[model samples]
Each structure stands twice: as C-alpha cells, then as structure tokens.
Target: MLALFAVSLLWAFSFGLIKGELTGIPPALVAFIRLGFCFILFMPLALMAKKYRPNLRLVLLGSIQFGVMYLAYIASYQYLPGYLVAVFTIFTPLYVMLFDALLTKRFNAVLLLPVLLSILATAIIVFKMPDSGQVLTGFAILQLANLAFAFGQVAYKHYSVTLDSPHKVNMASMYLGAMLLTALAALPQTIGSDIVISQRQWAVLVYLGLIASGLGFFLWNLGARQVSAPLLAIMNNAYVPLAVLLALTLFNENADITRLAVGGGLIIISLYWAQQITQRLENKVD
Candidate 1:
C-alpha cells in the first residue's frame, strides 16, 4: 500500500506534465518513449537476473499489462474528458477484485466494501455526466483500459508470489516486453510525423520515463506483492485526489477543496477499514 501511495505522489505531477508540456505529442509515441526509457534504465540491471532464466509467460503477461494497457489508456482520451476518464477509473478496484478472485479461484464477498468505498469516494471527487455523443464509446474504451490494468495487477501479484527471482529482474524483463510492443505500435505514427519535441518536452519525458514509469511501477508492483487484492484496489484510487490536489497547487486549476478533502479522507478510512476486516478474517481462518 505504501508503494502504491509513493507512486501516486510521483504520478501526481505527471498529469500536469502531460497536459501542459506534452499536450500535442502523439499518445502512442509518448507511451513508447516512456517504456523505452524504462527498458533502457533497467535492461542493464536485468542482466544480474540472467541466471534466473527469463520466463516467456511472465514476459507476455507484462506485455499485456504494461504495453497494451498503456495503449488503451492513452487512446481513451481521444473521446473522454479528463474528469470522465478519472470517473471511469473508479471501476478498476471492482475489476481488480473480480479478476483476482477469478484467477486465484477464491472469492471474498467482504472485499466489496473497500471496492465500493473507493468507487464512491472517487465518484464524489471526479464524477460528472458527460454530455458528449461519444460518451458511451469513451466509457467502453476506459473500461477496457481499466480491465487490462486490473488483470495485469492480479496476474503479476500471483506470478511474483510463486517466483524466487528478484523483483528487479522481473521488472527488467517485463519492461522489455512493454518496450517491444509499444515501439511496434508507435513506429508507424512516429516514422513520418514531424513531431519535433522541444527541449522542455524532452525533459518532461525523461522525468516521466525514469522516475514515474521506471521507479514508480517497480515500487507499485513490489507493494502489490505484499498487500491483498482489496488493499491494492483501494490504493489504486489514491492517485485521483492526489492528482487533483497537485493540479490545484502546481497548475492553479480550480477544484472543490472541500470535496477533495472529504473524498481523500474517505479513501484513507476505507483503507483502514479494509485492513481491519481483512485482519479479522485472517484471524478467524487461523
């Protein structure tokens, strides 16, 4: 959970960078560059894991989680407002629990409360009915992204638990998979476009790729390995309010301070409630 919260802080600044600095850049290229940087930064360190032997299944899983998921997330913006995108993401916690249960063959009805609280809290913060004709299309696109992300989280958590390999090794190989797919997807768009990135944009990409994608994801997945799926799901929503607060502070964006405060408080409360209930259930089992 702490790992996820750390990534939330790292990612909060990213919203402003993408909106302010890299607004006109092609989404695919942006995705590609981010993964490319991650791959470059970690591939060398991955060599230390050469003795562990790379798993093909894990690599493919990483491709889906990081590569395809990013593609869908970046594409959804074409049809949805930023708020709608954020609102749509509230469903991700539910998806995480559902997918985690399905994959692991264990069901916990109690997980629903945390998921519900997360959605409600996030909805309070970001919900606004879209007036656009393509609202449904955008919602669908965002859900696809959400499911992909949820699936990845569950899959990686399950996979990592079974492995004796180091986290850095797995991250290095996983990022390689992401880089390959993103590069392939972005190549056509980047080849001909005269998308000349200014120095400022380049700097933004470097920060996003190095700090955000590289370190942020490493810490998040590391945290995922330690927490329950419900906790992971709740923490997933942490970025919403954090991003909103950061936007207000750094970008001078107008937001409901009261709503932000209340919503964030609810999320924190939801986390605590989840931990308590989960501990009680574990004790019962023991």
Candidate 2:
C-alpha cells in the first residue's frame, strides 16, 4: 500500500511534467527515449544478478503494457489535455477488475460499485466535458492504453507470484521489451525527423524513465502482490486527486478545490466499501 501511495505521488507529477517540458518533443520519440533510458538503467543490475533468467512471456506482456501503451498514451496528448488523460484513466480499475475476473474465471459483481464510484468521483472532479471529435478520439485512444496497462498489471501479478526472481531482474526484461517495441514504433519518426532536445527535456525524460517508469512501476506491481485484486484495482485511482492537485499548482490550471476534496474523499470511501464487500464475500465462502 505504501508502494502504491509512493508511486501515485511519483506518477502524479508526470502529467504536468510531460505537458510542460516534453510537449515540443514528438510523443513517440519521447516514449522511445524514456523506454530506452529505463532499459539501460536496469540492464546493468539485471546482468549482474546471478539468478536472472529471461522470461519471454513477461517480456511480451511488458511490451504491451508499457511500450504500446506509452505510444497510445503519449500520442493522445497531441489531441487532448493531460488532465483529461488522467481523468480517462479512472476506467483502469474497472478494466483491472474485468481482466482479473476473466483470467481467473471468478466474477465479482460487487466490485462494480467501487468501479462506478471511481468514475463518478473523476466526473465530479472534471465537471465539464469537451464535446469535440478530436477529444473523443483522444479519449478512445486513452481507454485502449488504459485497458492494455490494466491487462499487464493483472497478468504480471498472476505470473510473477510463483517466480523466485527479484523485481529488478524481472523489470529489466520488461523494460527491454518496452525499449524494443517503442524503438520499432519510433523508427519512422527517428529517420524522418531531425529531432533535437534541450537539456531540460533530456533531464525530464531521464527523471520520467528512471524514477517514474522504472521505480514507480516496480513498486506499484510489488504492492499489488500484497493486496487483494479489488484493493489493487482501487489503488489504480489513487493518482487521480494527486494529479489534479499537481496540475493546478504546477500549471496554474483551473480546478475547483472543493470538487477535488469531495471527489477524493468519495474515492477513499469507495475503496473502504469495496474492501469490506470483498472481506464479507470471502468470509461467506469460507
């Protein structure tokens, strides 16, 4: 849970960071650079670890989760506001629940209440909607990205449990997978565009890749292992309030503090309610 909270803070700043710093950079290029940096940062430790063993399936999963998802996620910024990207991510918890149930073949209808609450909370925070075709496209793209990320999280939790491997070693492979896929995706842009980066952009990419993507992802997933599936799903929305707050403070974006406070409180209540429901259901089964 601490891991989730930590990553939520770490990831919350990212929307503003990318919008403020990396907006001029091609989104695909930004993604590729970040993934490359992440892979490089983990490679040395992965190589030195005596127990490191390559898992092809995990590599594939990570590619979908981080690599392809990053492509869609970063590109959406070209069409949509960063805050909306964060807002659309409210659906991720629902996707997480759905994917978990589909994979494990155990459906929990009660989880939907929390999922709906999460979305409603986000809607409260975002009182107005953009009725634009481009914004709609961005939302669609963001949802695809959300679904891919959620699938990866649930899949990794299920797969990583039996492994004795360290998270670093596993992450090394995952980041490498992201690097490869993003590299391929970025090739045309790399070849065609004479991309140049200011030192600030480079620094931001490094921070995002190393700190946010690298440590944040590892810790978030590690925390997932310690909690129930429903709880883990709820934690996915922990970033919503933090991101909104950061956007307001850092970007001077217009945000209603009252809405943020109320929405955030509702989100917490939803989590507690979901946990209680989960516990009662388990006790009934037992």
Candidate 3:
C-alpha cells in the first residue's frame, strides 16, 4: 500500500507533463524512449541477480501491460486533453475488478462496493460527456489501454505470489519485453520523421522514464502483490483526483474546486472501506 501511494504521487504529474512537454513528438517514439530508459535502468539488476532467469510469462505480461498500454495511452493524448485522459481512466477500476474476477473464476460481491464507489468518486471529479467524435475515439483508445493495464495488475499480483525472486529482477524482464515491442512500434515512425526533441522535452522524458515509468511502475506492482484484488482495484483510481488537482495547479487547467473536494473525499473513503474489507477477508482466511 505504501508503494502504491508513493507511485500515485509520482505519477500525478505525468499526464500533464506528457501533454505539455512532448506535444509534437511521435507517441511511439515517446513510449520507446521511456521504456528504453526503464529497461536500461533495470537490466543491470537483472544481470547481477544470477539466480533470476527471465520468465517468459513475465515477458508477455510486460508486452501487454507496459508496451501496449503506453502505445495506446500516449496516442490518446493526441486526441484528448490531459485532464480528459485522466477522466477516461475512471473505467480502469471497473476493468481491474472484471479482469480479477475473470482470472479468479469467482466474484466477491462485497468487493464490488469499493470499486463502484471509487468509480463514482472519480466520475464526480472528472467525468464529462464527450462532445466530439475525436473525444469518443480517445475514450475508446484509453479504455483499451486501461484493459491492458488492469489485466497486467491482476495477472502480476497472482503470478508474483509464486515467485521467489526480487521485484527488480522481475521488473527488468518485463521492461525487456516492453522495450522490444515499443522499439518495433517506433521503427516505422522513426524512418523518415525529423524527430527533434527540445532540451526541456528531453528532461521531461528522462524524468518520466526513470522516475515515473521505471520507479513508479515497480512500486505499484510491488504494492499490488501485497494487497487484495478489491484494494488493488480501488487504488487504481487513487491517482485520478490527484492528477486532476495537479493539472489545475501546475498546468493552469480549469477545474471545479467543489468537485475536487467532494470527489476526493469519497475516493479516500472508498480506499478506507476497501482496506477494512480486505483485512476482514484476510482474517477469515487465517
């Protein structure tokens, strides 16, 4: 849970940063750079940990989770504003719950409460009716990204329980998979384009790659492994309100303070409710 909260804070500024800093860059190239940096950062740890052989399952998981997710996520920014990108991600918690249920082959009705509350809370903060075809297109693309991300979270949580290796080793392998996919995706785009990244943009990419993508994702998955599915689902949306607040403050984006206050309060309540439910469930199992 600490890990999740830390990453949420770290990621709070990413939506705005990506939209603001990397506006003219190719989305695939941006993803490639970010994942590339992450792979470079983690591969050394994977190498030094001799006992940790790259797992094929983790590789595929990375391809879908980080690679595909980044591809769609960054692309959506082309069509939607940064805040709307955050808003559309409200569906991710629902996807997380759905994917977890599908994977586990059982549904916990009790767990649904927190997921619904989280969704409601986020909707209050960021939801808006799409007024353009492009907005709807962005929403659809963002949902695909959400599905990939949610499935990855649930899959990693279940799979990590069986592993004895450290999170760094596992993360390195996943980043390798992500790099391969994103590199391929970027190849065609890089062939003829005059990809000129300003110094400021380069700074943003470096921070995003190293801090946000590399460290943030590592902590998030690490935290996911420690918590229950319901808690994980709720935590998925924990960044929405924060992202909105950051956008308003840092990017000068307009937002209703009343909605941010009321919605953020509900999100906190939902998180607390999920935590209590998870503890009780664990106690019963024990």
RMSD of each: 1.3, 1.6, 1.5
Where does candidate 3 stray beyond 4 Å? Answer: none
- Candidate 3 yields a Cα-based lDDT of 0.88
Tens digits of per-residue lDDT, candidate 1, 172-204, equal 878888888988999898887798899998998
Better of 2 and 3 by TM-score: 3
The window of 10 residues in a row where model 1 has the poorest summed lDDT is 48-57
Q: How many clashing residue pairs, candidate 2? A: 0
Worst 10 residues of 3 by lDDT: 14-23
Better lDDT candidate (1, 3): 3
Q: Would you estimate the TM-scores of all the predictions?
A: 0.96, 0.94, 0.95
Which pairs clash inside model 3? Answer: none
The C-alpha stretches of model 2 lying farther than 4 A from their native spots are none
Alpha-carbon shift of residue 248 in model 1 (angstroms): 1.8
- Pull out the clashing pairs in model 1: none
Better by lDDT, candidate 3 or 2: 3
Provide the lDDT at 165 for model 3: 85
Give Cα distance to truth, residue 198, candidate 2, Å.
Answer: 0.6
